[model samples]
Target: MPKMNIKKYTKNYFMPPKIDMSWAFKEYPDKAPVWCSVDLRDGNQALVIPMSLDEKIEFYKMLLKIGFKEIEVGFPAASETEYEFLRTLVERDLIPDDVTVQVLTQAREHIIKRTFEALDGVKNAIVHVYNSTSVAQREQVFKKSKDDIKKIAVNGAIMLKELTEKAGQKYRFEYSPESFTGTEIDYACEVCNDVLDIWQPTAERKAIINLPSTVQMSMAHVYATQIAYVSQHLKYRDNVVLSLHPHNDRGTGVADSEMGILAGADRIEGTLFGNGERTGNADIVTIAMNMAALGIDPQLDFSNMPEIINLYESVTRMHVYDRQPYSGSLVFAAFSGSHQDAIAKGMKWRAEKKPAHWTVPYLLIDPKDIGREYDGDVIRINSQSGKGGVGYIMEQKYGLDMPKKMREDFSYRIKDVSDHKHKELLPDEIYKIFHDVYVNVEKPLALIDFKLDKTADGMRNGTVHLYSGGKEKVLPAHGNGRLDAVSNALQKELGINYSNLIYSEHAMEIGSTSRAMAYIGITGKDGKTAWGAGMDTDIITASVKALISAVNRLQQ
Candidate 1:
């Protein structure tokens, strides 16, 4: 391994002079910016195996369905597949009337001509031309002076105007100073202004000046300041769409995009999930969903997020990381005991109060809003789960609202099973554990039959047939109610005594059969409580069986 040397690296970015920091005072943008998806170009090119023409078409269709008004299909002049994809869209008339397709080309004349040819039959298109403008490119690669670089950009802009006039097509133009972050901020703006001077963009047909962090070289704030300087100094500002195309080399691509938008950039050019060269471009999904979280309509529809994820994964052969924000599989899952407990309580509050806005703890947005289920996505059960989470599963999935003390006891049993297995327990497995271990336990003490009748004084009279200790004994008892009457009979007949009997019952609505569910908790002589549950078609039978189950547990 080579020894790391910090002395060899110096900051390559230049801060714009007298940058207006006023843009930082506001919170996030109140409105959605113009979103331009560069997935088919930037994201696809970064893939190990680029998408085939058919896959590109499918991906483009999904982008359209997501409400993207501008989509950079590909760099047509760069490859045959890229050229054919654009031609196919034109021939099939797949481009919607409101959508404008964009193509990328170098400042070279041949590439620019081929790029325009690819968009020959398109109704609306953006001819995007870029030239490397960074100080590193000037000194190390091209060895060109400032004037020479400016001329190259100027000539490219003039050629685009000439071709549009010759073909009688009103194509909007866009110019990118590639690696703008590493370029002198003033020099980069000067080159862009020269290009705009030739295009003479009008309000009706506005041009785009995309400032890409082609290679991220500074903090997001520095990039925002650079964008602010360019936005202020640009010629024909009203007729230009100041755009951002930030890469994620420092993992701040989304931050740069956000701050740049706040700094006056009006459009964003990014790939889905931030897929691109090097680290990747800004993630459009994250940025747009961030707006949605802030109560701003992002103009894109991601309601069916799972379907979008499936298609993105299948087409790109890239897995969305399980921890990816908003769209990943586990982003909404709560497995920690504390997280699950809070989430469960928050859900209960939401149900009871029915709040107009989302305020669930630990959940930024409702999972149901993105086509995820509460039982499946949130409140996942594992050994780390606690009483509130386990209780929630029982109530939500099975309609068995166990008492609070019983819930704690049941949670221990579940945690033990999961800890031993070293795996997550599904809802059905959780219910199975509850049923097998705690429900209707028949053992040394069993209920053969029982009957209860009301007395003339409004007290309950009861008779229970018991089979215990290898003998069957018939006993009669009376108390305030049928359950109390049964409890008195059990203590007298079986020679067992306990106090503070806690019980609850509800209709089991989640199962196939119409059954009543009952839970019973009894405080033993030691003052510790044992819990058991029972289910039956009749409510009285369910409660009686529950008492017997609790007694069996307590005796054990």
Candidate 2:
């Protein structure tokens, strides 16, 4: 074997010019850039089965609801279905006045004419046109000169201007020098500025000059520099909305988009969950949420994120990665013991003080901010269980606040079960473990009946019927409290001696129920402790049941 000459195959990509790199040092975007979704076009094209007209409309409505003002619906001239979808929107008057439906086309006269025709009767539209001008695209694919490519873009702009005037539609214009990252910056600038010059954009009719990292070439910083240079040098700068269309070939699409925004791009073109050709586009969800985390309004609402993810998955037939930034099923979940403990304590602190910031450990925002509950979604239970998380689950889900030591004790039992079962436990299942093992246990010391009466001296008199030692015994005793009197009666009559009783109680605030829970712990003469839980409407009755549960476990 020839050792394959391992390093011979790869070559360095073309890097952009080394201009001033000041734009790369900004902290973060103070506001969201204008968001344009190409989900219906680029995203749909990538799907194995493109969305039907009905599904596309449903997804469009979702995007509208998410606050996207610009949507590239499809390449209307490419297919009848695409043309029909555009026609349906225009005829149905579904496009809102504030929203602009954009359509993509190559820099060809016939296709640009068909694109405008399909957009007939539309009140607001952005007719987007592009042609590849990268070195590889020009030399390998088109075999055309720079002058030839520039003429294609200039001609497309002229046709758009002529037809839009003829139709009197007042449509917006967007031009992309596709594969802009691979083209020489000076030449790319010349093409974009020429398009702008022909369009003669004004304040009333601003045009968009989109610089796509059609394929990411260099690192994020180099891309930012290129975007910064274009933003600085482009003619008709104020009337030009510099937009970015980044692809994830290098898995840095989001990073490129973020850097580009900082480098003076005014708008972002992406799809929900980054659904596009190749490795997919920059995920608009991530960009928006990242802005939100920094206290900047992302301008897009993802409050009902679960429903959004569900709808996107259903329509796109693409599964969102479980760790996808904000919309994933398990993005906020904590499974490690240390992680769970910090999150549990952080949540506790959040509740106690209602802090002005979201400082919950390992959590960027409240799960409730996205319609997720903290019970199962946040502090999950598994074999790696810790006291803080298990106890948090108990307190949040079922309202059973066990003592600290007892919580520590109970965590081990839950972990043992989870380790054996080889799976994570849901809230109800974890509660079931606590109920089955510790709550209201009655075996050898089953309480058949019990009554308590308060006397004038503030002492409690109690009567109990029990099944102990395989026989039923009746006993009577007195003490300072009802539960104490019951415990005394057991010790005196049944010779069961235990002391150091600990108790706590709380009402279950979840679901439709008036039930209360009581937790009791007792240490016997052997210094062995047993913990028990009971649920009932009456606190006293719940406590009595809990005491018996502890006693039964102690005897065993």
**Model 1 residue 89 CA deviation in Å:** 1.2
In model 2, where do residues sit more than 4 Å from their true spots? 1-13, 452-462, 497-499, 507-515, 524-527
lDDT of 1 at 296: 93
TM-score top scorer: 1
Model 2 score (lDDT) = 0.88
Model 2 residue 425 lDDT score: 89
Look at candidate 2 and tell me the lDDT of residue 350: 85
lDDT of each: 0.91, 0.88
How does model 1 fare in lDDT? 0.91
Candidate 1's residue-wise lDDT over 363-461, tens digit each? Answer: 999988878889988988889999988999888988888888888898999999999999999999999989988899887778888888998999999
lDDT of 2 by residue, 246-301 (tens): 99999999999999999999999999999999999999999898888899998999
Q: Which candidate is the best by lDDT?
A: 1
